[model samples]
Target: MYQYSEFDKQFVRNRAAQYRDQLERNLAGTLSDDEFRPLRLQNGWYLQRYAPMARISVPYGELSSEQLRVLGTIARDYDKPDAALLAEAQEKQTALGTVPVPGTNRQVGSELKYGYGHFTTRTNVQFNWIPLVKSAEVMELLASVNMHGIQTSGNAIRNITADHLAGIAVDEVADPRPFVEIIRQWAALHPEFVFLPRKFKIAVNGAQEDRAALGWYDIGLQLLRNEAGELGFRVQVGGGMGRTPIIGTVVGQFVPWQQILNYIEACVRVYNQYGRRDNIWKARIKILVKSEGQAYIDKVEEEFRQIVELDGAPHTITQAEYDRIAAQFAPPVLQRQPRDAAAQQVHQIIRADAEADPGYDRWLQRNVLPHRNPELRAVVLSFKRLGQHPGDCTADQFDAAAQLAERFSAGEARVTHEQNLLLPWVHQDDLPELWAAARKLGLARPNIGLITDMIACPGGDFCSLANARSLPIAEAITERFQDLDEEWDIGEIDINFSGCINSCGHHHAGHIGILGVDKDGKEWYQITLGGGDGSRAGGPASPGKIVGPSFAKEEVAGVIEALIDTYRQLRQPAANGRLETFIATLRRVGHEPFKAAANAARFVEKEVA
Candidate 1:
């Protein structure tokens, strides 16, 4: 985790003050709503259906104990701690057949205290029900902990993500933290990128596992140590999911580490100059790349060359600067213990005993993985459960997570793109105590990358931009798949639901993607199949292929059941995870088999007539 410098702290404080001034002017009627919209969005204030949603950046998903405590403090003190009491008071008034009047006990009801910390797939934290007037105070609180909301909302290269196990992964070629930070630092409030064609996203991955999902980003960079022993980035571009879903294309095969920043600048510069600006629907850089094809590539290369040709080139990184940033991310020294065969045998036997506890076995199977250091392990703190919203946890849980990190590992935790927390340096020998501690804190759910561990946005529940309520669907799916043995048997399936076509769920990459659409004021879900990551490097990630047609909310679970059944029946026998099996089965069986199955399921569901 990189700490903020004095300059960084001052910059954030100033930005908060600046936003405060803008908000005050807007409130005073000096600036109209339209005039103030961009200002608010850039500051992470979105006027949702119910209230303002403030998204705070957890830079690269990194959070120190102090930072996590601050987030909990904000959620506790400002968001209101006694939401249940307020709700009870409201209910009593309602039962008495009286309207809860304003400036009375009703004032407490309007406190809007039920909100919790929401972790997004982009690795940011969102606080719903934040009032516009209190946003500046939130920003000031965030500044105290080296976090901010800039580039989180507007059309800018949003927060840069990297392999969640950046420095600690077993098979990583390099640590992407330094480069990711460099991008975040340089791109922060870059003048040219203020108003691009649309919002942009970038990801960096150095792990052999490609956990970052490189193919689904605006710009995905995979770090590589070539035959010559020099590390550089292999660039992919144009890929995004929304209404028009497409996997990114490789723009640069291998860019030198020194010139990677400048190359990225060139790519965005090209996008900024000529990307569509007329129709909001086609405003994305993905549209431009798809429209122009090779010509787009040519333009980017030319721009990059021009940039490289310039005197004292902009976005150029000096060796000293790179080294300085890299030093901040250098892995800590840890005692190395021999991971002998006997030790493994002992662990396996001990694990089997631990598995006697139902949830403990699932915890071992799902939430735990070996780290690069033989003595340590990476522990995932799942926010997904039967009734819980994906990526959501209480203020107390946040504080407890920080405490766990301080006691068990480093005094830091990392957020995942899947909306979970990661203790990256927990000792393997301490799994029992860690699991017990986390379970008590409500931070352990033991469902990671399974069907029940769904991805969803706030949808119509909060966001005005949504077409339907996504959380209910997610909850339904989780309930339907609550049986642990059956879930494990079904195996690594990804079912992502998006309220609308904005595709915040990354539905395009789910094996079974459900997109909620408004059909004559009713919610209808369009299912997509065979959506997933590339099986190998340099291959396109599988974009969600539409099955047959949309299904009503009631038909969703059955439709998914049919799709899974199709996969179970047709998949070639292999030891691959169920998602990979489903993808492979789709490739071999094509869309027809799944479509036929879905249609048959829908027809059967219609009957009992």
Candidate 2:
């Protein structure tokens, strides 16, 4: 994890002070809401559906235990709505009705939850109920910990994301964190690019597997060495998901590591000049790249030439600069004693425990990931349980996670793109103890990539842009798959849910995508098959194809169940003797069977139990 330097600390405090002044001016009636809107957005304050929402950036997903503690403090002390407001919000939510249970009329309603943080696909934490008047206080508190929401909102460069296993993964070509931090520094508060046509996102993947979902980002960088062993990045551009979902094109095959910022600058400069601004829906760089494919690439190359030749490429990264940033990411040494004899004893104990407890064995298989160092393991704390919304963490859970990080993970953790927290420095010997502690805190369910482990955004219940509620749908699916045996049998699947066409939850990337829609002011869902997140597991980054007409909200679970059954029936045994995954089966057999099954499920009403 990168420690904040004195300069960096002072810079954050200064920014917070400026925000407080602006906030005071606005509150004192000197500054109007029209004038304050942009200022507030630049500082990551959003007037959401009901109250103020704050998005705190976790750069490259790295978080210190101390930062987690501060986040928990914010949730516990400041994320509450007024009593009257809470009552009104809950009343409106209660009227939305409950999710229907197949085979019966049993309904489950949505509960308005607060005082919690949501982990986003971009690895940002968001609070939905903080009052606007206290925003300055919140900003000052955040600055105390060297954390703020600078550039987290607005039409500027959003928080840069990287593979959660950036420094620890066994298959990594390089750490990627140093470069990620470099980019973060370069892009933060860049006056020239502060307000682009629309929001821009950048992601870097240093590992062999595409765990970062690189293809789904506006700018995706895959680090590798060329033929001469020169470190560089394979740059992909123009990828986004919303009303339009397109895989990024390879703009630069192997841009020198030192010139990454220059290349990105050229790309952004071209888009800033030519990208659409008149229409918000079509204002992304992706749309520009799509409309002018080779033309867009040519323009970026020309701009790069001018930046290097005419402007002297000021942003080129130097070895000294790279080294300065890389030094901050030095792996922390564990305080444990020598591991020769104790390691073997722990291994023996682990083997015995696994043999004695199937649940522990299952947890080891699902939640534990091999680290670059054989002595360590990257452990995922599952937030996708039955009672909670996907990726949501209560104040108590946040505190528990901080304690776990402090005790077992060298006081550091990373928020994953899958909306889970990864303790990147857990010792191999501490697996059993960590699992027990995490399970007690409701953070360990042994379902890392299972069906219940889905991705969903805060939909209509909270987001003004959403057409329908996504939480109820997510909860319904989670409740239906409570049987671990069944979920395990189903295997790894991405069931991404989005409340609208914005694709916030990356539904277009799910193997089974569920999208909320509105028709005649009723909540309906559209099912899609054969979507992927462009990983070895999910195959490739691609938008799913719709099955048929939209079905009523109540039919969504049955539709999903029907699709799973189709995959189970059509799938063949793999070389490893396990059944083929849903993605593989969907590809091999095509979407006809799944589509037919999903469509038919709408009409096949179950009898009352």
Candidate 3:
């Protein structure tokens, strides 16, 4: 919601001009793919599985209606134009399969057509095309919208995320949006922090629910009310997921709100100065935190803080400035009315048709949350539905979502870390119409934060770092658990899958975690249980215990199923009937039964074979 100032606008424009020149040189054959790759990557462009995919950073999943409109325009004008090419390729492939032609014009054309366009994560709107020719144009358009692709890739400070419900959530002690925005502005072109050994991630959580997934960030800050009743942040550092995933350490306690920026600057300086740069694998802040010990890190951080405080606090932010930034994020004025009548009518119809309504009902219950306004609500449509490619959104779909956001949701939509779309501020009066529109666009899935809403990564298909195919495995699990009613009855359980140890899918933070690994060139998975994000009443759940070494790909879902059944049998009911309550009950009982069930299932399957 932050508006770009003249300075901000000029900065992006200059970056665009620079990229345009780089693109022009590459196109003229003055620069090769090797040279262009890093330059393009710095600008959020990638050569993906299909064509060249361009990823535009939304910066912590926050966007203005106008900025989103520009994104939609880009998708429509630049990417979707390849639809004709796709159709032609499909026709040619069909022909090639039927006719036994060694060589043909149709075949050649088909090959050319197939070479164009590709798939991308549902959360990232990717443009698949040659970059050099249109780089200048893309730059110019993006600049006009006050956008740039800086630091979206490489070892730079990747996207900084804050709770999507930062200011909106009633349970928050303070809104951390202003703090996140300030950090974003300060870190954009910081000289010392730009080129770390590995990527650095930061997440700010203002919600009681830990929507930012604090346990998985390089640095996670939770806004809290100090004993003095003043706003402050509790700092957690070193949390990361990779080959050697580790939970973050609490390096700092009760950092005053006014000095938040200075504190962050100090923290980064500590990491920048001491973090390993020689070995890429061992270069993350997590490694530093682990090697140095939290006490040592805390001592260094205190010294850094003193130095920063004495050095005039370079990135110091004021309450007034904070207010000015916060003002930009004011919620839209909503109309007062009863819930959508047409949607209610559809609800009735679905209720009458038990089979159809059951799935939708489950989806609505889990995915939809009430809007601040009386007559409206927000819907979080989980694109992370079981075996689907998580966070993959097509160019046309991007444009369509943008259009839909503009029409019904105050021209704004949000992308969740869970790899889902949130149609925030939808009017209840328009719910039916919006639902129909979303259905048409295939964005109307009702699973928001359920087991079926599993987070996954681009595994063997595209990632050079993956050990196996995560998407297909996730799909398999989703298909196995296709019964929505049963899933809802199971309640709020997180079943996160990671293709490899990197854990981009956040397997370490899941109540039920599945991690993909390699065993003698064959795909295998490891299961972990009882982990969670944020500070819960029983103190945050620790990293899950690994249930076994690994299991064959075919046996992964069955292992999960067996664990769930064990959990259900052992669970003690909570007052609200939530799964979190059940999980707490199960955690108290320990992992023996779950492990036993999983091992027994594997043993039985092996005997049958």
TM-score list, all predictions? 0.89, 0.94, 0.83
Clashing pairs in 2: 98-108, 534-541
**For residues 1-609, what per-residue lDDT tens digits would candidate 2 score against the true structure?**
897899989999999999999999999999999999999999899886656789998898888898899999899899888776566555655665432211011123324445788899899999888888888888888898899998699988889999899988899999899999999999998988998999999999998899899899889999999999999999999999998889999999999999999999999999999999999999999999999999999999999999988999999999999999999999997898666988779767865765588888888999999998999999999998877888888888889999999989999988988899999999887888788788788888999999999999987756767887788778888888899999999999999999899998999999988898989878888888888887888888899998999988778888888999898899899989999998999999998988888888885544211
Model 1: per-residue Cα lDDT over 262-305, one tens digit each? 89988999999989889988988888889999998999899898
* Model 2 TM: 0.94
Candidate 2, run of 10 with poorest lDDT: 98-107
- Model 2 spans with C-alpha error above 4 angstroms: 87-113, 337-355, 603-609
RMSD of 1: 5.7
Instruction: TM-score winner between 1 and 3, please give it.
Output: 1
Residue-level lDDT of model 3, residues 1-609, one tens digit each, is: 566678888988998888888988888899898999888888887764323556666666765566666665665466532565445434543553422111111122323321111222212344454333565677688788887677677777776787765566657777787788778887786787777767888888887777776767888988888777988888888888767767788877888877777777777778887888889889998888888896557766786668676787656678798887788677777544454999678766644554354545654666667654567777775555432456655455556767887778777777776777777777765665666667667777776666787777766544446676676667667876778667766767777777778776777777888887877766778888877765442236356779966877777777878887887888875667644453576678988888898887674333101
CA shift of 159, model 2, Å: 0.4
Best-first order by lDDT = 2, 1, 3
RMSD in order of candidates:
5.7, 3.5, 6.1
- The Cα error of candidate 1 at residue 91, in Å, is 17
